[model samples]
Target: MYKLVKPLLFSMDPEAAHHTVSGGLRSFCKLWGGKRLLRTAYGCEHPALRREVFGLTFRNPVGLAAGFDKNAEYVEEMAALGFGFIEIGTVTPRPQPGNERPRLFRLVDDRALINRMGFNNQGVDVAATRLRQLKNRENLVIGGNIGKNKLTPNEEAVSDYIQCFDALFDVVDYFVVNVSSPNTPGLRALQEKEPLTHILNTLQQRNRKGGVSRPILLKIAPDLTHDQLDDIIEIVRETGIAGVIATNTTIGREGLRSGERLTAEAGGVSGMPLAARATEVIRYLATQSGHAFPIIGVGGIHTPEDAAEKIAAGATLVQLYTGFIYEGPGLIKRICKKLVAG
Candidate 1:
């Protein structure tokens, strides 16, 4: 059904199609237990699919990754589609218009996308307001992924993270500290030991002092070195943050089936080509932490086997971004059903 409608969708701008899909979903869920009926039909209900991690009960291990619903606009719609959870936004403290137009692109031949979206979203406060209304829904776990403003100097980035932490503490289930997006200038530099520790520790401090604390997870880029991954593990232990998201998108273009110009496009590449390196990162984090820490595996997870490989390699759960674009909502049922087989 979606495949037939996809060409019509692809004819429009990527962002426009995203909004259209979200609006349609929001309306569909209003149709007399429409959300419930869709979940009963499309969602996987096997008990083996349930996994507890970071103080939350996920109906299944598969979640739609952040950057899909950057402002919490379609959490209910996505939940209706049978995703166990959804991560919303790489939201900033203050809303910004992000980069120029045509920032998102699709390469159909490679089943990949290149985006320099620059975290374009409504600020944390607006997003939190939208999210606070959805708290009572079932089978819908939302993770708030936050980041610094584009204009904020890198030195003062922690303050931005702190602001978002305070505003969204009561709304989201888990917090993904996003310092790995390639679109934001100098954002990846925060991945270094000293800066990363400062941000994580400050957020931890605020979380402890706040009325209610949310699980804080650090999201890293796959482009980091082994030494950097070790630093992340040490930081997690030192700060006692909940878990690690293991990866964001990567700038590396290795092993792409598409030609030079597609690879040469200016942005982060995601989709099928990201699988191996992302799984390797998950394994490395597991090995480095002695499997004591939980990691959410995300990258090129397009099939049941790709998801199972990440779980075996030591992911507490898995997330999808580009795969969701190429494969449609049924991908969740496909992956979760396979988990029941094992």
Candidate 2:
């Protein structure tokens, strides 16, 4: 069914297709028995696939990475597809229209995607409202991937993150401080040791003052050097954050068969080209840190082997974005089946 539909979706502009598919799924999930039917077809339940990480028990380890559903509009719809977890947002304290048209590109030949989506979302408040309305989220572990507004300067960025974290703390099961996206100007600067440590420390201080302290994780970029990654490991330990989401999309475009025409696009690249380096980054962090922290490996997992490879590399859990787009919803069930078989 998806194979027949993929051509039409692929024919449309990438971002437009994204909205169309997401909207359609949301509608479908509202229909009578829609979720049960989807579960029967795509859900794989097995005790071996269940995982306990960061104090939350996941039905499985596969999660839908952030940026697929930037807002919290489709949590129920995505959950119906059988992912153990779903991460929403790169959301900010305020809403903003993202980068200009033609920002999302499909490099079909490479089975990859490039986007300069600039964390476009309806702000954390809107998402919190939507999350509060959901009645069936108990089974799905949700992570709020929080980021600063594009207009916010580096100096005051901590305030933006704090506001988002505060707004979403009650709703999401966990939080991800996203400072690695390449689309936002000066956003990656927040990933540096000083700013990163400050943001985490401040968030930790706030978490300690509260009711049920939710897990906070750091999401890092794949483009970092070994020294930078080492710094991140130390930062994780120092701040007492839950863990890290290893390897966000890369700015690097070397050896892409997608050619200069598509490769020349200015944004982060995700998919097959990212798998090796993403795995390398995961391996480096896990080994060097002596597995000191939990790492959710996410980059270019399009197959069961890829998921297995990430786990072997020491990822406590794994996530998919580009792979879900390329392989369809069945990918999660397939990956879980393989994991169970092993």
TM-score of 1: 0.96
Model 1, span 1-342: residue lDDT tens: 788988988888887887898888888888999888878877878888888998899999999899999998888888878888899998999999889978887877878888999999999988999988874567567898999999999999999999988888888889999999999999999989999999999998888884778889999999989998888888999999998886788898777767887678788988877788899999999998998788999998989999999999999999988898888888889999899998
lDDT of each: 0.88, 0.93
Model 2 — TM-score against the truth? 0.99
Q: What is the lDDT, from 0 to 100, of the residue 289 in candidate 2?
A: 91
lDDT of 1 at 19: 80
Q: Given candidate 2, what's the lDDT at residue 172? A: 95
For model 2, how big is the CA root-mean-square deviation? 0.8
In candidate 2, what are the lDDT values of residues 1-342, reduced to their tens digit?
Answer: 788899999999988999999989878878999988988888999999999998999999999999988889989888888999999998999999989878999999999999998888998999999999998884899999999999999999999999999999889999999999999999999999999999999999999884679999999999999999989999998999999998799999987887788999999999999999999999999999999989999989999999999999999999999999998999999999999999
TM-score of each: 0.96, 0.99
